[model samples]
Structures are given as structure tokens and as C-alpha cells.
Target: MDGDAWRPDLTSPVGFVESDSEGDLEPSDLESDVESVGTSVISGPPADVLEADPAIIVAVGDSAISAVAATDLDVPVVPVGDVPGLSAVDPDHVSNALESAFSGDGRVRAHPVLVVETPGGGRERAVFDVTLVTAEPAQISEYGLSRRDESIAQFRADGVVAATPAGSHGYAEAIDGPLVSAAVEAIVVVPIAPFVTRTCRWVLPNDGVVLSVERDEDPVVLCVDDRTVERIPAGEQVSIAADGALSTVVVPESADGRD
Candidate 1:
């Protein structure tokens, strides 16, 4: 997605969602700052702010932006705190960031969302990545990767992670997975502690990517981002694909020099 595709309109009201841990920065104080710019402010929790349908949302922390991203809302978000893969501004720069966003001086980057499905019609959406790992520590298991019914690779490993391009910079990168560009419509698949000394990692298309537990010596669990969703029985298949993208405002002053 091009950075200039979307820009906030300062003429309309904007929403504000802040983290609870921001001790000195009260909601009213932030609201006052936003109002200082002569723009109407819609101040409340993420859900409430979304309900009002503000022109844009300003999330104040990692947790705050994560909450907004978890929702199915498609509105553009202006991250105001520490958010990975985003050009997020400091809390003190909220006013400047808002001006940049509304004045069309900021760039908008789209982060793809992953849709994960399991047997018996279970489905979930992930903003970052989805992982399938052994429930027990250090337990080896055989897993298979496939796309469009064609086998990609089968190997014995502790687990596997399928991360979005934005998510590739985190856990996946730490495990030797390639860091994918946000503009690339691909998923990064990396084996976790493979039994073999030499293993292969993949950057595959987002659609029709499947991971199955070929041989589960121990139980396995599925994780969407940070939270464990449920245990996966042996032989069950987990499917993942790119669904929609999250639009984020990227201000030049806040960018950490990452693509």
C-alpha cells in the first residue's frame, strides 16, 4: 500500500485510545491537547471510540494500538507511543503527529492481517503472527508445511511460526527467519529448533499456507500473537492466509528507520 493512499481530515473529529499505565497522562489531559489543535476529540476506550466513528484513531501505546488492531475496524490509526513496525511518535509529540497526519504530511503504511483457521470451523485473526508449538518444553515433533495442497517441506522440530511481514522482525527474526518487507505480500515460515542441523526457512505467499502436526510426540498449542488459543491434537491442520490490512499513519519524525 502506498504511504500517500490515506490521510486524516482535520476537519472531522478524531478518536483517542490511551494505555492505562500512562500515569501522568490522563485521558482528559490528552483530550485537551487534541482539542488544543482546534479539532474535535472523541475520547474513550477503543470500542467506544470506534462506535462513534471518528475520522481517525490515535492510539497512545503498544497495548492501545494492539487493541485497535485486534478489532475488525478498517479505519486508519495514528500510533502515538512505542509500537513496532510503525512510525509511532512519543507521547509528548501527539499534537505534532496529529497535525502531520491530518495535514497530509505523514505517510500511511498498511500492515496485513493474518486469518488462521483450524478444524471444526475454528477461526481467528492475527495482526502479527500465528505459531504452533509443542505444549511441553524441548519436545520434538514432526510437522509439515504446504501451500495450495502441494507439500512444501516436512521436518521434525520443536515448533513453527508463520509471521506477517511486519511480524517477521520480532520472534521470527530472532529464530533466524528472514525479515520481510511490509510491502511484500508474503508470510515468513521458520522451523523452531529443528531436529536436523540443517533446515530450510521459507517466505511463501500468504494464501493457502497450511501447517500440520505430522507426528506429535507431545501435545501442541496454537498461539495468535502472544496469547495461546488452544491445544492442537495430532494430525489436525492449521490454515493461514492474508485477509485485510491495517492502515497506520507514519510520521517522519517518529520512524525508527525500518521499512
Candidate 2:
């Protein structure tokens, strides 16, 4: 019940006869009706809000590029959930996507990192020189932040969160990073266990925009899944985004020449 959504208790009116009033009144049942009639109000681009707009544009790289925009226009995101005629499909914005994809220098050197408190409250200095090989940080680096996930992990820095649809099921979901429905249309970006992490996870960046985290405090640190690399020491920078990469899927629908 924090940000995006919440559950509420429903109540109904009831009638009763007072002992002084010589009348027999039928008492109304409120419990069962409340339980049966209540409905969850799915947050973000509610079906009704999306009904007003017609275009639901989602770019490649699993970024919710058009999600908020479409929602703002009252257009339903492609597959925020299932719709009778809705189907999961590839994003139409590919030219730019391909440009970003190929632009991958097989390297990213952007954002400047900063130091913060150590998880154990020690003066342990840590850094990260993460290389987005086949492994990850590929997408996160797309933002070209100064020294984002590209750095290795260290004590001061707990870890870098290279979030995606595949990894989002866990903590990402908890942070309200958009849920990946059965259909593939959105991606959730979440940073886990960041020593100086923000109170809440930020939204995934589009292929064009950049996500830069400022080091407001003295020192900061990010360990890679808890492993220390010591590259992103205090006062460094970082970058993130989807590298020019494609994860092919073999859905039966695609074989049928459809989504």
C-alpha cells in the first residue's frame, strides 16, 4: 500500500431493529458481500485510462519508453496485461535501437561515481571496473553514466544493480519496477543492496535518455552481487542502459508469422 497500488476494505450499510421499537427488521449481511464485491485497482495505466489513447509504442531493449507516455495519453501499454485482442510484439522503434545497439563500443565510459557508507560501517574502500561482456551491465551501461555499473564492486560500494526482465521477478517486483506480464513489453530497472541506494528504485531509462545517480553523501559503494571488485572507489562515476543486444525468443506465435 506504499506507492503504485494498494488493497482496501469494503463496507456495506446494515439495518437493525432496536428492542424498544416493536418491529422485526431483516439484518443485512456486510462481510460476505464486501469480500465478494471488492476488486483490485491495478495501478499504472489503468485500463480505463489507456482506453482514451490509441497508440502504445514500446521501444526495444525492454525499456518502458512508451509506457508512461502512452499511459499519459490514456493509451494502454502493449501488454501491461492480457487483452482479448492484445499480443506481445517487438517494438516498432528499431532504427534508433539499432543505432544504440551498434554504437556499443564493446565499452561504456560515462557517469562519475561517488563514495558513501560501507555496509559493515567500516572505512573499507571499494570500487568497480565492471566490463559489460556477454555477462551483464550491458543494458545498464546504455545510459552512459560516468562510471555506473561499468566499475567493479568494492566495500564502500555494495553492488551494482544490472536489472532486466529476467532478473526483475525478485526484488525488482518489490520496488514497483513494472512487472513483466506473460507477454513481453516492459522491463524493470532495480538496484539492489546499494549501500547508498535511494529510498526507492528509479524507472528504467529510455534508449535516448540517461540515468545518473548522484553521490549526495561523503562515500558510496556497490558490490557485485556481494563480491568486491574495488574499481568504483569514492568520487567516481557510472553509466547504464541496454547494450546493443537482442535476446531472441522462440514463441509459437512468432512461428505463425504473428507476435
Q: Pick the candidate with the highest lDDT.
A: 1
What does candidate 2's lDDT look like per residue over 141-247, in tens digits? Answer: 21123223442223222223443333344334554454443233223344434444443443343222122333323323343322343334333343333332221
Q: Give per-residue lDDT, candidate 2, residue 2.
A: 9
- As a whole number from 0 to 100, the lDDT of residue 98 in candidate 1 is 70
Off by over 4 Å in 2: 1-162, 174-176, 180-187, 191-198, 208-230, 251-259
Assess candidate 1 and give its TM-score to the true structure: 0.88
My TM-score estimates for the predictions, one after another, are 0.88, 0.27
Candidates' RMSD to native? 2.4, 21.5
Q: Write the per-residue lDDT of candidate 1 for residues 1-259, one digit (tens) a residue.
A: 5565456665667888887865434456556655765677787788898888877887876667667777779878877766666667777777777766666777777889888898758787777788989998889888899999999999999999999887787788889999888889999999999999899999999999999988767998998887688888888999999998878877755757254
